[model samples]
Target: MRSGFDCASFRVRCLHADRGGRLSAVERQVERLPEELVNKIQAGEVVERPASVVKELVENALDAGARSVHVDIEGGGAGLVRVRDDGRGMSRADTELALERHATSKLRTLDDLQAIATHGFRGEALPSIAAVSELVLRTREGETEAGTEIAVSHGRRLHLRDVGHPRGTTVEVRDLFGAVPARRKFLRAASTEAGHVAEAVTLLSLARPQTGFFLRSGGRRLIEAPPADGLAARLFQLFGDRLLEDLVPVEGGADWAAVRGFVSRPDRPRPSRPSLRLFVNRRPVRDRALAKAVSQAFRAVGGGDRGFEAFLFVEVPPHVVDVNVHPAKTEVRFADGRTVWAAVERAVRQALGEGVRELPRVEVAAGRGEATGVAGRAAAAVGTFLDRGSGEASGSEIEWGGAAGPPDRVAEAEGAAPGVEAPVPVILGQHRLTYIVASDGDELVLVDQHTAHERVRFERLLDRAGRHAVRSQGLITPLVLELPPELRPVLADHGETLRELGFDVEGFGGGSTRLSAVPAILGQKDPGPALERILRDLADREEAGWAVAGTRDRLAATLACHSAVRAGQALNRESMSAIVRDLLQTAHPTLCPHGRPTVVRVPREEVSRWFGRTGWRRS
Candidate 1:
């Protein structure tokens, strides 16, 4: 036991100990680097991300007024990013002047940042990117046979070299972040880098509907939007066939002048509004007012809960909006933010009212019975969801199935959890070959036709997997996944994660992914696309800030969920039963990792109430 005075003394002593006057001073060290070193440092920021380099080159191409933009990248642009456009090329004077800091063909006065209309008006972009990487720019006039090539690295102009190039400008950046190893280490694997690069290209394409675009990574074509008349056609390639039918054309104007394009499908929305690409005057912008208006408009059409992929373009006069707010050139300041907001919301409201085309529901083969595999979870809860049968829809069969259930019983199962507080699965009257289920009282549980089967499949799979814990099923023929080279390290770091998920990933000599074994649950599925989907999901998750990969077992569970049977699969009763039993035994039987309700429930009492009756009063 210490006295209060002693405790006070102890506290005072600790603060006094940290007092700088009581500590000894160390000698100071300072040094100055040459001018050359400073330029290289500046270059590092301009070309920090792969997208940054691409933006710089593309801006030059756009500012040059290229109708067609072709971007080719390797390793997600980490290895190399090349942008070629059919625009006015640089002359000897232009090439040399372009490399100089603050040299520009766009801005004269600092105030010009106010009415900036070009895709990019920043004069710093070119020199900044040039200072950090091995940059080569070759340009030629349309009629010229020979072109001038200028090479730069770390801000120093390599001796001017003459080269033959097409009648346009081609800018190539290789070995990004090479000068700064710290930044290089931050880059994701090449494949992921390529995906980001692809996203950048998509943004650019959306902004310039008139530009003919061709994009490829690792020699594989990502997009080929070759001068299409409408944004719908472009979206069809990036998203899917859904946008074509769901897109609602918006045509309206406010005092500031506005043109809007929005997609209105309630079923397909992302979790964030960042997905909404809003542009002003051919420049992609992330405006709070515009985005809020779009959100409100969407909420009006379909409640606030769901998300829709929207591409809304709003064009204001150059004088009305200021584009020079940020160096990245993403945000904007409209003359009247509220006016722009009102116009954007009005346009979307009118468009949603106009209505888009809806496709008829086509039932395909989905498991209604026992979903005993990885994809069978949701299917087990309800019943087989709608499935697509052999169709000429796209020369492939689309299977759809309903939740294997008489949807009402899911409520009873959910209720049993709070009252009983045990592992027992409360069964409701089973009909339509489905188990309507809810778990932990509140959260919904849904079983897919395939996942129901997967539970059973994995049970059998694990039983077989017990002895060695290393089951390698060699494919008849190995499948190859072409990825950008930047992602090479991520694969190397998470090798065990791949193996545990039933992916026998072997590194092909070059920067490529070779699959020898795939998860057993994917039954006869093409391993290439499956792996890519999983990888894409992983990459997307990385963006969402969930990067703690602690244990292989947990990671395996994640991959298993990803590779498991989906709800939209087909199954029979036997498979569904195995899945139901397995889920009941599993510790986490309530929700998927993503927090989506596995299934929703409607109790018998609730169903009776709908019929103007009550379950509590039995008369």
Candidate 2:
């Protein structure tokens, strides 16, 4: 036993000595990396993927004062990326220096960094990109008879020569990350990478509407925008007239900081916050506070919990905003974030208020031949009824089959237990063709007609969907829709779900779709608007990380909202009565599918107290 223990101890000591000797042999030192390695490392930071390469090249073209820019990509920008721009080109000397790290003409001193007006001030784009791929740059100035052509391979200059070229710059990058297998391996599928590249180009095009931008991938033209007159024209060109009509112009701010752009109407909200695009000094950025402010402003003016779409541009002194916070330059830090937030909020609020005022008012025919605004007429009728101390009216009166009751009549009257069904109330009339004014014995109940109908439709749709019994209604004349290219794939992906919901949709080619049928519940209503809303919702759901069940539920709710009666539509007594009856029969009568209140009850005592008649009752 003693000999065995001694042998084990000796082996352990030998192992420790071996480790110490190995540690002592290795030197602890630091040294600068070689130029090639340095460039490759920089590329890792600036060029995350093919999309990053496209972004840097495009920004450079725009910064060069390019009036027109054309981009072509192959293999989702992995095999080749070429950007040709009609911008100021570089001389032979400048072209050679452009491939070197930390070489830029946009900045001279440290102060210049504080007020960067150009997008390529960092000067790291060229060298960093050249480090990981084969690059060829051909540039010619207006004064030069011949252009300079420089070829580089993995941070090494291969050749420089004079060639005949136009007065612009063309950068062709091939085999991106060819030398860095690690990065190349991390790239996603070709289609996904192509999507990212398209998004980058779209953002840049949106920022510079005055410049013509064209993009082609795999020999297919993806985006083509001519020089637009302004932002509105650009929007119309990109998204078509349907989306443009839904946006209202927003303009306001102080001299120090100003904001201008377009915001979606409160009634036409999007499904996700990413729809809100924000730009600071004509540069797209992601700022949470600014985005939140826009949402808050929308909510302040009756835009509910749903997401909103906005294109807001904030202009401030360049020094007041820091664009160097990230290597990608997609985020900005403001000097006075609070002030900026307040300005955006105020501007959006004012624009929404003005938009609401400019909207066409609903007119209702009164006694004789006179016509008055819905709100004015509704108020006058309510006042007259109160002064006369009566709950009865003649024309337009909708009778209830059961005893009068509120949304929670049993609880309010007899203090009954929860879950007891409320009696159907008498539908007195409609207020502004929106709310159903009802009399629940001694209470005045206001029911949102749209929401009430929406609830009924939602419950029915849910039941039908669960049982896989949704009915379809064919149309005589098919509807054709023009959608953005990126959204076309969404339809194909959710084609099964849409068909289950009673829509017969098929691609009509080139960003157009044909709708041959729709859900029978929609009746004669125009499905164009509703279809657009559903498409947008589905697109948002793709990135929302929701389960399949949640997505189906959302689809059902959206269908119900579009199928139900609109707020401004005039409803007859039968329609009003049907809505009230259907709503009461629903499992959740008090709330809509989106969880908004469907009915609001003003107790008899509360109304009487306002008129100093609480202590008196009819004898």
Candidate 3:
């Protein structure tokens, strides 16, 4: 009995040694992750959110030559996302291969990567999306009589069957990131996600104006844009015709490249740039170099502070621009960035010179909708957010919506007409000769003289821009000035724009130009210093590799700055009243051309609270 027990103990020790050997092996060795796990890890990079999934599927449809594409989303695309397209679909075998990583027919050789024209060449989008969601693909190829339908969930194929379908494709994704709940927690609220999805669709539709696009949420159609011939027509369809007054068409080309797009004029500015789009080879991309060039061109014209919007389309040889910079394919690197920058800058300059006229405002169909789907999301994101700088009004004759007026309204209410204009404030006096102090019975307003005048002049310039009728003051003695050789091109390129701004410049041989006239708004001030500053601005711009184009707005601002009523200049009450009237008439009365607040209002109640004479709310 004792020997039997000893043998049993020996066997137990042997078993423990064997287990230890196995553990040692495991600790020393490294094994590749399972295929499913590897695919899921790859999916983490590509399928970031519902919007990323939407962007990929839409691009795939577009690459397939879809004439009309439709997107449907629910729960901000977390619950379900379906994309339908009338494009050339794939066969059963190709559809099966599409679920696998790195399986794509878009590229063949190394050279194909350099000149990628298709929106999606990496086959990663499909496999990555399928790895993390329940994906269903229904496709009917042109050669096949029946359609092929495949179901995949979490990188596993559930079924592949023949189904009846039209000659197109449909992709549906359900419960995105369901297999990985950790990723799902990172998603934003439904409305914010919907906004991002809507923005993606808007940008894609803008890039492909020839293709029709429709987006819906919860079975309600939000966007329905038909195929259009030009960018203007497409923009009109997406944003409505209010943009007709804002957009300036810019077109320019050189030997190797061409650029054509629309830029907003200086007067029409936004706080954020939601609509600024840039495309290369018909693919939408966010290239900083191109955007910087465009911004610099606009700034050269004093439209920098207002925050401009533009849709710039650059056409270059596909090989010259690399579209494979990022996995999402939203960025591109140009081969010769200087050439592209020069082209874009020149185009904007020419377009600025040819002033944009406000076309008849047409009703925007997208604007008429509740805040639910694509229309609402896109419109809300891009609509004018009336952010009054400093959150105060400038001029005294302004209406403060429905809640502003005298506290004792009954006294002034007798026999007053309902539509009567708000009474212009009485000018109390000037503060330090820089600010105009005015009282409207409730509050005292302080207006910055320089900023106020700048705003007034900018509006006048915009109004005259359409008519090309800026009054000119002919120089009593024609100022013939010798300019540096570098500034000669600035004169030649912007000659017409300068003339329209009331500068009559004639160039002569050997770096000499004669200035016969200047803007009448300059009054008795010397034009010599202003002109020199403008030349210096142009020269500095050129030195920075930006085109010295689109300087009309800048020149106007320069002229206004130099000619505005100086501080300490004593003005009579009539002049102050006239200034106040003009100030109220200007659009964007709160901010100057440079985006600084022109006025600060101090309420009488606030002053009383500050003196501790009455109870006040502590902040």
Candidate 4:
């Protein structure tokens, strides 16, 4: 008497098929029951606190393939968090099951946990979200274009109807922990909670290197990590151009996993390890054991407390690590993380030994591109970085001053072709990067290697970024960097500062960043060298708290000295003149970013005395 097939047949099949499948019927029964119990279960996993809810919902959007996710929170995660994504939307029934515990399309069995690849494998995120907070999810799917809204409070689902929603999902949570007053009492200060929320946002944004992210709290935008095309592009977009300089490429794999990130040079260490970022399959993890191995290897390569920064990507078979280890997968347990550690150590060591880490950036002496005796050793140190990708094609030779990474280089290789005059003066009458230039004046001028050049460029771009939008050129090739857990925090804390200086700071996948665009001046050098040098510079600057204005000035002096250009480099005629002109246009051009006088013009008499043409004249 019954039809050949039944509508409920498909869902019923799952009851006997597997564990996750078996739970589907139970979940449906639970959803039909009083909504209170249902919401409470949902709240258990999603709204533990402000950051927890933020993390869950954000992950939901990310898993849905959101390219640009926006999070707006008020009074931290406690007041409200409205997350909207430009991903595939949900239909009426999809929205209903979405708010139920253990109901998910991401998994079908417990065995799925072993190879969990998506950001949200647990079906609990959305439901857990509706429990504690007044949750509202609005969406539209393919043909169900009118879109519907589902509201749940204290674990009860509201009616759905046509709502003004475009093509994706927009979830809003208000008064988090409103039902659970006890939980409210445990909340931290707004700023502290805001910081946690920011951190959560940063982590998720990093996991999806190509996805764009925006976070705002109390009506103020806290973070904006744009979608990058590739890993290096993402790194440059978020972390800044400094991390790209003098980068050593790391290419190695072991036990079915491959790892890649930048290693800082000996001169590039930072005071802390914040610059050391690491990612596994593009997810940043806090694996102490694995990070320890990196620390050891980094130390072996030489930059002391001033350690380096790397945007590393480690691709492992999904089964090797258990992503289900925690609600927040920030901490990972790889089947063979130790093997990863050893491989990283060896990769870095070999990179340094082969001189792969020091591709044409700071620390190289001032000279024509040809390597001298010492330069040859320096080149050897950076060889690993140079080996992997395309090397600079200029054949112009390495022209570097012992200086910090250019704020400009974090984005792209601005052509050597000079358009706008560079703000900084060059050493020995050179064009900005050309290193030499011609002048129309009677008196010949020598550009100060570092300060003069930086002064003009720094002021120009810093001002430009402030006045208009920050100008970031897309990099044709990206520089990938790898780092450990310890240094990633420091990078997070100081990301705002670096961004002001022209870096695109975001959590690159897990700990790895995909480099994208960069500033124009840095040219084609990778960003790791720049990050390494800045880390060292920051270490010196942070050695003392900005004690006072005087103290700050003193710190600036030190940073300037460390960040300034050093002696010995070749220059082309136009580059030299540009440096001279840029200096004349800037303040304190005579003195560098540090207090050192960039240039000390020698008098004709002094020049003559070297040949015994004249003696000192009486004043």
**Where in model 4 is the C-alpha error above 4 Å?**
1-48, 246-249, 274-276, 305-308, 351-619
Cα lDDT of model 2 overall?
0.69
* Candidate 1 lDDT by residue in tens digits, 1-619: 1132223323333433454352234221111233443333222134558877887788778878899998888887988999999998876555655665545667555456567666655556666666567888888866556788988764555656678988789988888768667678989767667766766777888777678777777776666677767777666545545345556678885777686676565433223223577777777767766667777876676434334456778877777787766667777777788888888888877776565223223322233443434434454332211321111111111112111232222222212223333343343322333343434343334454233433333343444445446344568888766543334434654677677656788766544568888655443445564555455445555555332234353344344454443433433334333355555554444443433333345565665677777755656
Q: Which ranges of candidate 2 are over 4 A from the true structure?
A: 1-44, 178-181, 269-274, 357-480, 488-619
Could you give candidate 2's per-residue lDDT for residues 25-129 as a string of tens digits? Answer: 433221223444334322225778888888999999998899999999888799999999999888776776666555667765556767989886666677778
* Residue 573 alpha-carbon offset, candidate 1, angstroms: 16
**lDDT by residue (tens digit), candidate 3, 1-619:** 2232223324333433454444343221112234553343222256788989999999989988999899988877888889999899987667766666655667655577788778876666887787778899999988689999988776666777899888889999999888677889888655445555766787889888899988876654456678988788887766556555567787896657799988876445332332368888888888777777776776565443334578888899988988776768888888898998888877876676565233122223443323234543343233222111111222111111111111122113112324535566788866544577887778877887657766676667756866887778788888766542224445555677778888878775434578888776654244543464455454333323321124576656544544444333333344555456567666677877556777788998877678775644435
Answer with 1 or 4, whichever has the higher TM-score. Answer: 1
Q: What is each predicted model's overall lDDT from 0 to 1?
A: 0.57, 0.69, 0.64, 0.56
Query: Worst 10-residue stretch by lDDT in candidate 4?
Result: 1-10
TM-score of model 2 vs. true structure: 0.61
Which structure is stronger by lDDT: 2 or 3? Answer: 2
TM-score of candidate 4 versus the correct structure, residues matched by position:
0.52
What CA root-mean-square deviation does each model show from the true structure? Answer: 14.4, 13.9, 21.7, 15.5
What's the lDDT for residue 403 in model 3? 17
TM-score of each: 0.62, 0.61, 0.55, 0.52
Quote the lDDT for 299 in model 1: 67
